[model samples]
Target: MPNSSPKFSYIDYNAQTVTIKRLRQLSRLLDTVITVPGTPIAIGLDPIIGFIPIGGDVLGLILSSYIVYEASRLGVPKKLLSRMIFNIIIDSLLGSFPIIGDLFDFAWTANHYNIKLLEKHLNGY
Candidate 1:
């Protein structure tokens, strides 16, 4: 009898690796890196950009949306995609506040969370 499992001849694992690596770097840069000096916490461009006004969060949303788009292209399941969207929405909404929003952005790390979701989905978990 012939095997029934679908083949993945067209899937390029190397390309996927490069894409994921780039996404991981972006997530780290946007979420965590700089030390708070006097504290144990670290923050990145996400909170720094949040200082700008409407444009900050908008930029964050755009960058994070790219990750979601890539995940969809990689065949992530609908449920996982929905969860990823929820994370982005939460980050964008809460990170739009005044001083508190910057703090939220520092702690939320939606890009990191979405990457984890993508990894989980790819691993069949």
Candidate 2:
């Protein structure tokens, strides 16, 4: 019998390392894993956890920071890494607010933003 598997020559599966896969999953878990009923908007644990007061924000920061750490390990340039750090900082600062901060988390999505930065770096953008 002849081989019948389809191939996509343009798809570079090797380009996605294990770290990248984990980061993508983590980003989604932090930013867009849940959908709001009757609305197109989606949210993730980052904001929902932020409702727990001080500890929640700290935990969110820690999780978001891990993305930057992984990006550094992936050899992203220092300049780009700084931008990722800035995103975390902004998210942390604004997200420290009481009610408003939780609302901001729904939109900020620092993990998702940082993943984009990391991908752009990896893609040589």
Candidate 3:
């Protein structure tokens, strides 16, 4: 028999968890694509986050994978999931380069693609 109350607990997703904020930053799914008034769009956090010496960019890539994992848990198809994984791979591999990699991270956004993949899957088109 099932528990009377519940087997699962609820979390207030919008109720101010810093993890949420970090996740958002790691994901970079927001609109507006805010930037310095005159700054070029080619350089941003994608590569900036990778500038953390040795493991910084890799760590950022790892964190980005969480979103894809979530999508998998949500039953996204394996073919599409492969594409998502490929995006992360290309981002991580290219992002592992020295100076250029960090710049690439800034320019390219794997998370944005993952988010889009989810949105498309959700809409079922």
Candidate 4:
């Protein structure tokens, strides 16, 4: 019988190249897409939507978790992965507050931080 599999397989993801590019774009979108007027501070949808009570934090958690999930797929070390998780957990927990949580989100760019960790590992740092 002739092979019936598709041309592209799951192994074709090319995590080192394509995945990194996509993750970088996602990190930027989640953590720094918007710049505060007349200030150096910038933020993205993570905090903006975080103002939506329970659902907002849940959404942020899911999105932040995606970065960690991709990092694991990229073969990031367990130690580093744990650190990334810690960042996400902290972001989710403390960021669940009302006023302070939003403020925390403004300063805590967990996705960006996680991406940096991934790069450091890839760069052998």
Prediction 1 TM-score vs. true: 0.86
- Regions of candidate 2 where Cα sits further than 4 Å from its true position: 1-16
Off by over 4 Å in 4: 1-14
Candidate 3 lDDT (Cα, 0 to 1): 0.67
lDDT of each: 0.87, 0.88, 0.67, 0.90
Q: What's the lDDT for candidate 1? A: 0.87
Q: In angstroms, how far off is 19's CA in candidate 1? A: 0.9
- Give the range of the ten consecutive residues with the poorest summed lDDT in model 4: 6-15
lDDT by residue for model 1 (6-77), tens = 644366889888988988888888888688899988788888988998998899889889999888877777
Give the C-alpha miss distance for residue 72 in model 1, angstroms.
0.9
Candidate with the greatest lDDT versus the true structure:
4
- What digit string (tens of lDDT, one per residue) describes model 3 on residues 1-125? 86686323554444424544454565763212456577555334556657788777767667778877766655668998899999899889988988877666766688887777776775677
> Model 3, 96: alpha-carbon shift in Å?
0.6
lDDT by residue (tens digit), candidate 2, 27-72: 9999999998999999999999999979999999999999998787
Question: What's each prediction's TM-score?
Answer: 0.86, 0.85, 0.70, 0.86
The residue pairs in collision within model 4 are none
> Model 2 clash pairs?
none
